[model samples]
Target: MLNERISAAKQIASELHAAQEAIDEVMIRIARLAGTLPAARRDTNMSAIVGQDAMAKVAQALAASGDVRQLLTDAHLALTATQKQVGLGTRMFGAGVKPPSAMFADEGSNDRGVVTALAQAS
Candidate 1:
């Protein structure tokens, strides 16, 4: 029974990690696209084609994605607690409890500066 549970714990941790990663990736991409919308609208030929509200819409998505990422991060913390409860210990998953932004900042491996850029863009 203990072995089965340990295996399950590993699987859950992997899934949670993947979920965090997917959200981060999408948020970064959306924010990048949001950053470009204004430039796209500035082209005289493109201005006629780009909706005035396009930038606002993309920014909204980026912000909402951040919220989603936060929720997932919180879930990760909760899962860590459960891991401890089940005697899997703190080292069962990640090395430490760093938030996604700081852990993956500036390396372009995660959604670190993307949120701030989104806020400033607003």
Candidate 2:
């Protein structure tokens, strides 16, 4: 019985190690795909606007403005925060630390990303 228990423990450890390796592989693949996305979407015509007329120049300037950058930054932050919250909620509930409703309420009072961006702009 003792030898059987030891063998069972070894098998469990081996399975856990295999699961971790699979998780790492998935993470690496996700990172590689994310890295390629920006290059794939890059506009090749970016430099072709150099000889464009005044209206195009103005449009380009507006598009490149700090306000637009800040807006995008805020949106990214909000998305990241939402993702983190959801992940935390999942882990918390899985661990029996909190219920689903409690997790939802935890983020209800925060408009942190927009507020932070607006403050930075000022």
Candidate 3:
């Protein structure tokens, strides 16, 4: 049983790692696209088309990777379980943790509800 559990854990980790790798690749591509966005928006350059093309490619890549969906589902389940255990905020968007825009919004606050509301709006 222990071995089976270990094996399952390892598989989950591997799948999640591959998904993260895909996400990292997508992020890098998106970053490059973002860098080009400003210049593209300013001028009718070929880079604008290229940026859109790159974004489409990234989206395609993500869509093609089934492990990405599985990994996200796994993460959602884990987070949900964690939230239940902690008896805290909703797990819809990673509640009970530091938000990325928290620094811009406020200091010394765990207002996940607010964060969640803003995120949903976006």
TM-score of 3: 0.37
* Count of backbone collisions within predicted model 1: 0
The CA lDDT of each predicted structure is 0.71, 0.44, 0.54
> What tens-digit string does per-residue lDDT give for candidate 1 at 16-111?
888888998998899789767776677545744577677778888999999999999888767766766776653444444564333432333335
lDDT of 2 by residue, 82-103 (tens): 5455443211211222222333
Q: Ten residues in a row with the worst lDDT in model 1?
A: 101-110
Candidate 3, pairs of clashing residues? none
Alpha carbon deviation, residue 29, candidate 1 (Å): 1.0
* TM-score, per-candidate, Cα-based: 0.69, 0.36, 0.37
User: Which is the leading candidate under lDDT?
Assistant: 1
- Candidate 2 residue pairs that clash: none
User: What's the lDDT for residue 28 in model 2?
Assistant: 60
Quality of model 3 by C-alpha lDDT: 0.54
Segments of candidate 3 deviating more than 4 angstroms = 40-122
A best-first ranking of the candidates according to their TM-score comes to 1, 3, 2
Residue 99, candidate 1: alpha-carbon lDDT: 43
Off by over 4 Å in 1: 45-50, 94-122
